[model samples]
Target: MTRKLNLLLATGLTSLMLLSPAFAENMLRVSYPEDPKSADAQMTTDFYTLPLNIFDRLVESETTGPGQSALVPGLAERWDVSDDGLTYTFHLRKDVKFHNGAVLTADDVVYTFDRMLNPATKALNTDILTFIAGAEERLDGKADSVSGLKALDDQTVQITLTKPYAAFLALLAAPGASIYNRAFTEAAGDQFGLTPETTNGTGPFILRDYTLNDSEMLEANDDYWRGRPKLDRLLIRVVSDPDTLRMLFESDEIDVFDMDFAPTQTPYFYGADQWKDHIVSGPRVGIYYYNINQLKKPFDDPRVRKAFQMSIDRQTILDKNFYGKGKLEDGVMPRGLRCYAPAEPIAYDPVKAKELLTEAGYPDGVEINLQQVSSWSSRWSDMNQIIQAQVAEAGFKAKIITTDEAAYLAARKAGDSDAYTQVWSADFNDPDNFFYTFFSETGSKTRGYNNNDPEVFAAIEKARGMTDPAERCKLYQDLTARIVDTDAAWVPLFSLDHSFVVQPRVKHFIVPWNGWSDMSYYNVEVE
Candidate 1:
């Protein structure tokens, strides 16, 4: 029987039977709050939990310490950059092999880049690859392949960019840039990530079995170049209910509980004497905020936007909804980025907010739908409710709309909502990654922001290409001020610290700066 069919047939069995210590001598069980949108690397931002382990990129991120990471060689051993910094030549590691026993080569690297950049593929993150020369042509459907990608030999691949980008290497280290097996991917066709046969790669783990919306069974790749994983099997259960997740962990049914912990219940785990040594926490490299669509009514006016920003009690929300585990900031840039700076403190002035709304021709106030994905995180729903109440006192009626992750993302992309709350984790550590992804002309339009500001966009575009480090940093600081103070583009919230509780038996587990999405379990040991 094929692996897909076997998984389907076994779906009826209880997870306890399959994950028990008696059945699998060495297994690490974990919980995810929701089912990943897609297992395909290029197709998802929500499913990095799977792809981070199931595939290897040209380069990989190493977690040096809390809120810190450095790029290291993955499939590619090393590379050389041209003097002008436009060209990058990467040397392939000869000992690497895909899950299907196919050799990893320069041709595979070329094919991966071509597939991701192709307009026909509808890859969600092609924006990250636009810096490559000829990428615009391919994405515009004017070329069959990326002209800048070349396989010099069986072991070497070269990529040329339109301009010098300091963050180009950091972009390659993103989950979307993971290398794929050309032959296997081509043969799988449209069913690539949906089926077991097509989700193959050259990483530390293999997709042994997957049952949609319930669980994913992964096994260690014995042929892993770095070393065989200490654990034999990794069983990730899809447990959405916070109560159920806590029950599983306390009963020893799950080995690790990280991002799935509810904010309210954190005090329980923190105060417990037994769980003290098992808990790990650190600052994350990301932002949590509300995305305001300028095309929408009421928000189209600058006064309304600024009023909306002033209406919310950000510090109160952090304390009550998030258990005061995060640090509040007024600017969009989070703490871990190099360009981070302290801005003027935000005020929660309902009277000022009412006056601004009155001046904007809405003396009676306005009603807006504030969307949230409750399924993604319960704490978010609680936060949205608090926002709804706070805004009400400022002469605004905010209706809370809830949806699932997949639907929420689709609506956000289509520009279908008045306003919504969301979190954006860094694809890479560069300041350019944050500014360019959320504020640039293309980024703003595609994300349904409908924002138009030539000066801000021009500054962002220039910052990405400057080779001098000090100049680039200064440009970023100016852009941050304009986006936050002048334009009021989005409401800045707190940066929450990432916390995880692991079983005493599980040791050396690394907590990534970006939280669970960037976590890798290859180096973790099970006693």
Candidate 2:
């Protein structure tokens, strides 16, 4: 950071805290990639980072090691599951309270899930709650509430699933599953998460203030259940331009920028002495793959899909596309997960690819289109062009198309595109997130891919209910092989390690296995 910016921050710290005499201590400023779109946690997917820190969930994933997290209690102090594995009862903490001073209760938990499951609410990631008994019924508007969820008393919430699901706790730990104040939400109406004033959560920090397209400030909640935060205040500002973000970090205007810097920028930042000490790189639970749309003619045929999958040279792409910053992923799960069983990916063979295409009745090669984001920030467009050439080598005519991020997502979700580059981050620690999310009928809306095969569906469903670890392991492995090797539904790609640059003053911040470690409860002290 520059000397001028350092002096300015020191002066503003005192002036800003004048409004609240109690908050004139430690301050941490960060440069964020984009502004949050919504305040309601369940309405959006993983795009909103504030909700992860502002609103506490029933359970939270505590970072253990790089690319590793363990499920721990959050609002619910303790929980127990019945021997049948279908019933789960949570004991809520009586001492916890929302930022509004309302006591956290079992009723709030019930209300949160009910609101998310309501057909009218149009929650974005309600697929996580599909295992809860009567969830389907409630979502279908056949019932007003989820029959499986009940408040036994003021401090307890019991949930019964349709069957034994091992990852139920992990699913509850997701950000979208965080608890909120029902009274406050209803009062905020349609404008709940639009501004800081309308958002009330039960987390470590309070929404101090917000300035659209500029920055937002957060003050430590003095009455927080986890005690006061180490830092008195957190100032998050937007610096979307990569060059501008790099300059701010260099000028000492920002303390840390956790968002992944551009691929080219990452190497330069790591090698520079003034910035090298602040670098933190760790494995993340995310995969960037190409989603195939079977709604199209050639992609609809299993033979065509297999032919396309068999032709790709994954090694060259990983080394060239990502600059060797990630690991080769052959299956759904990454290298760190327990269910992970790595196998050699299919070798790239253009000759074999052509033979398969000929057998599939496309002897003269077929025309297919590829889609990607219009932005070059993440290098999605460049990756698309690279693959377009690689596939064209094996009797496939590939056309590269670009559109804005939102339009590209909408087109993919509508199954209107032939193929599109996509990314999926782990919501929990289970293999079910990979198998159920991408390949099962259970995740039809969430995946937006073609997965109507009956055998694959049976394998996924059977794996979900397998109580024995040995059996579950066997089934998960089988399902992974079917999806990646045999079925070739998705073109498996590389998994990346999130790279970040922190200021030297920042201390004791750990990275989460998932994207953006839970900064909510970290001991962030700025010198």
Query: Estimated TM-score per prediction?
Result: 0.85, 0.86
- The alpha-carbon deviation from the true structure for residue 3 of candidate 2, after best TM-score superposition, in angstroms, is 27
Compared with the true structure, what per-residue lDDT tens digits does model 2 show for residues 241-324?
878888776776777766464456876776788777778878878777878777777877777887787777777887886667
Kindly report which residue pairs in candidate 2 clash with one another.
Answer: 1-251, 1-252, 2-251, 2-252, 39-193
Flag regions of model 1 displaced more than 4 Å.
Answer: 1-17, 34-38, 119-122, 191-197, 261-264, 292-307, 349-384, 392-419, 445-451, 515-518
Q: Candidate 2: where is the Cα deviation over 4 Å?
A: 1-25, 140-142, 259-264, 293-307, 355-366, 372-378, 401-416, 442-452, 516-521
Which one is best on lDDT?
A: 1
Give candidates' CA RMSD values in order. Answer: 4.3, 4.6
* True-structure Cα RMSD, model 1: 4.3
What do the candidate models score in CA lDDT, each in turn? 0.82, 0.77
Candidate 2 to native Cα RMSD, angstroms: 4.6
Summing lDDT over every window of 10 consecutive residues in candidate 1, give the lowest-scoring window.
Answer: 1-10
Residues 300-338 of candidate 1: C-alpha lDDT, one tens digit per residue: 898888899899999898888667778887886887766
Which candidate should be chosen as best, given TM-score against the real structure? Answer: 2
